[model samples]
Target: MKVAVVKYNAGNIFSVVHALKRMGVEPLLTDSEVELRSADRVIFPGQGEASNAMNYLRERGLDRVIPSLTQPVLGICIGQQLMCRHSEEGDTDCLGIFDAEVKRFQPVKHEDKIPHMGWNSIQNCQIQNSKSSLFKGLDGEFVYFVHSFYVPVCKETAAVTNYIHPFSAAMQKDNFFATQFHPEKSGEVGQQILRNFLEL
Candidate 1:
C-alpha cells in the first residue's frame, strides 16, 4: 500500500519515517498535492508551533488538500492540533476536521507543568466507530506526550488522559484519526496503535 507522510516545515518527521520503516512500509514523505491525494493512506505528523505549521500548510496549498483526503489519515501531536477547529497556542484557526478546540495548559498547582511532557496512561478509551481504535483496547497503557496544549473531551474524543486534567488522548472523525501523544516514541503500545491505523 502507498502511504504518504505529508511533509511540512515541522519537526519529528524522521521518527515517524523510521517507525513506518520498522513496519516494512517506506512512507512517501512529500508536500506535493498529487503525491498526497493519490496515496492509499496519509500520515500527517509534526511537532511545532500551531500558526507556523498552519502557515506552511497554507503556503503549500496542503491546508485544503488534507481535509479532502478520502483515505484514512492520521495526525500526531501538532498534526492533531491542526486538525481541530482552532488552537490557543498561536490564536490560530485550524483545518476543522474535528469539532474541537486546542487550549493551552494552565497550571493550577506548583507541580502542574506547562509542557506536560513524559509518559502518561490513557483512560476512558473505547471504540468510537466501527474501525479499530487508536488506543487499541489498551486503555490503561502509557504513551509519550510532549505538549503545552490539549484538546478537551468532546464528541470526537475516543480516549482521555489525565495530566493537569482530563484531555483528549485520541480522537476520531470518520477516516480521520489523531493522537495528542507521540505514538512513535511510546514503545510497544505505540507501535500497536500505528499498526491499528495502518490496518484501518
Candidate 2:
C-alpha cells in the first residue's frame, strides 16, 4: 500500500514518517500532486502557525488538491486546525473539510496554561452508535498534545478532551480524519491509531 506523508513548510513531518516506519510502512513524503493523489492513504501532519502553513499549501496548490482527495486522509495538530472552516490563530480561512472553527484557548485560571501541552486522555464521542475507526481498540487512551488553539466540540468531533474546557481531540468527516494531538508522540496508543488509519 502506498502511503504519502505530505511535505510542507510545517515541522514534525519527520517524526510522523518515523512512526509509519515503525509500523512497517515506508511512506513517501512528497508535495507532488500526482504522488499524493495516487497514494492509498495520505497523512497531512504538521506543526506550525496556521496562516503560514495555509500560505505554503496555497503556494504549492495543495490547498486545492487536498480537499478533493478520495482516499482516507489524516490531519494532525496544525494540519487538523487548517482542515476546519476558519481559525482564530491568524484570522485565517481554512480548507473547510470539517464545518468547524478553530479558536485560541483562553485560560480562565492561572494554572490553566496557554499551550495545553503533554499527555491527555481522549473520550471517544461514539458517532452513529459506534466509535470511530481512529479510536478502534483504544478507548480512554492518553495522547500527546501540544497546541493552544482548538476546535470546539462539534458535530464532526469524534473524541473530546478537556483542559481549559472540552474541545475536539479528534474529528472525522467522510474520508477525512484529524487529531489535534501528536499521535506520533503518543506512544503505543499512538502507534495503534496510525495502524488503524493505515488499515483503513
Candidate 3:
C-alpha cells in the first residue's frame, strides 16, 4: 500500500517515519497536493504553531486537498488540532474534518499542569461502536501525550482521556481519524495503534 505522510513545516515527522519503518512500512513524505491525494493512505502529522502550519498548507493548496481525501487519514497532535473547526492556540481557523473546536487547557485546580504532558490511559467513548481500526486489539490503554490545547468532548469523539476534565483523546468521522496524543512515541500500545491504522 502507498502511504503518504503529508509533510508540512512541522515537527515530529521523523518520529512518525521511524514508527512506520518499525511497522514494516515506508511512507512517502510530501507536501504536494497531487502526491498526497494519490496515496492509498494519508497521515497528517503536525507539531508547531497552528497559523503558520495552516498558512503552509494553504500555500501549497493542500489545505483543500486534505479535506477532500477519500482514503483514511490520521492526524496527530497539532495535526489533530488542525482537523478541528478552530483552535485557540493561535486564534486559528482549521480544517473542519471533525465537528469540534480546539481550546486551550483550562486547569480547574492549582495542581493541574498547563500542557498536560506524559502518559495517560484512554477511556473508550464507544462512539465508533465496535473497536475502532485505530484501537484494534487495544483496550483502555495508556499512550504518550504532549499538548497544551485539546478538543472538547464532542460527537466525533471515539476515545476520551482525563486531564482536568474528560476531553477527546481520539476521534473518528468516516475516513478521518485523529488523536491528540503521539501514538508513534507511546511504545508498544502506540505501535499497535499505528499498525491498526495501516491495516485500515
Candidate 4:
C-alpha cells in the first residue's frame, strides 16, 4: 500500500516518516493536491503553531483538498488538531473533517502543566467496532502525548486518557482517524497503533 505524508511547514514530519519506515513503508511527502488525492492512504502529521500551519496549507490549497480525501486519513498531534473544526491556540479555524474542536486546558492549582508531556495510559478505550482497521490488535494501551490543548471526550473518541481529566487520546470518524498522542514515540504500543492504521 502507498502511504503519503502531507508535507508543509511544520515540525514532527520526519518523526512520522521514520516511524513509518520502521514498518517497511516509505511514504511520499508532498503538498501537491494531485499527489495527495491519488495516494492509497494519507497521513497528515504536524507540530507547530496552528495559525502558521493552516496558513501554509491554505497557501497551497491543501486546506480544502485534505478534507475531501476519500482514502483513510490519519492526523497526529498538530495534524489532529488541524483536522478539527477549530483550535484555541491561535483562535484558528481548521479542516473540520472531524466533528470536534480543540480547546486549551484550564489552569490547575499548581499541579497541571500547560503542555502535557510524557507517557500516559489510556482507559475506557471505547473501540465500538472491534473490526476497526485501526486498533486491530491493540487494546487498552498507553501512548506518548505532548500538547497544551485537547479534544474532549465524545462519541468520536475511540480511546480515553486522563491526565487533568478524561480526554480523547484517539478518535475515529468515517474515513478519518486522529490521535492527540504521538504514537511514534510510544514504543511497542505505538508501533502496534501505527501498524493498525496502516492495515486500515
- Candidate 1 vs 3: which has more lDDT: 1
The predicted structure with the larger lDDT, 1 or 4, is: 1
Instruction: List where candidate 4 sits over 4 angstroms from the true fold.
Output: 127-132
Worst 10 residues of 2 by lDDT: 123-132
Q: What is the descending TM-score order?
A: 2, 3, 1, 4
Order of the predicted models by lDDT, top scorer first: 2, 1, 3, 4
Query: 1-200 in candidate 3: lDDT tens per residue?
Result: 99999989998789999999888898899988888888988999878889999999999888899999999999999999999999897898899898888999988889999889899998884674666668877768899999999999988998899999999999999999999999999999999888888888
Clashes of 1: 0
Question: How does residue 111 of candidate 1 score in lDDT?
Answer: 97
Those runs of model 3 whose alpha carbons end farther than 4 Å from true positions after fitting are none
lDDT of 2 by residue, 32-94 (tens): 999999999999998999999999999999999999999999999998999999999999999
Model 1 Cα lDDT, one tens digit per residue, 72-160: 99999999999999999889999999999999999999999879999999887864544336665577888999999999999898888
lDDT of 4 at 173: 86
Error of 3 at 2 (Å): 0.8
lDDT-better candidate, 2 vs 3: 2
- State the lDDT at 200 in candidate 1: 73
Deviation (Å) of 12 in candidate 1:
0.8
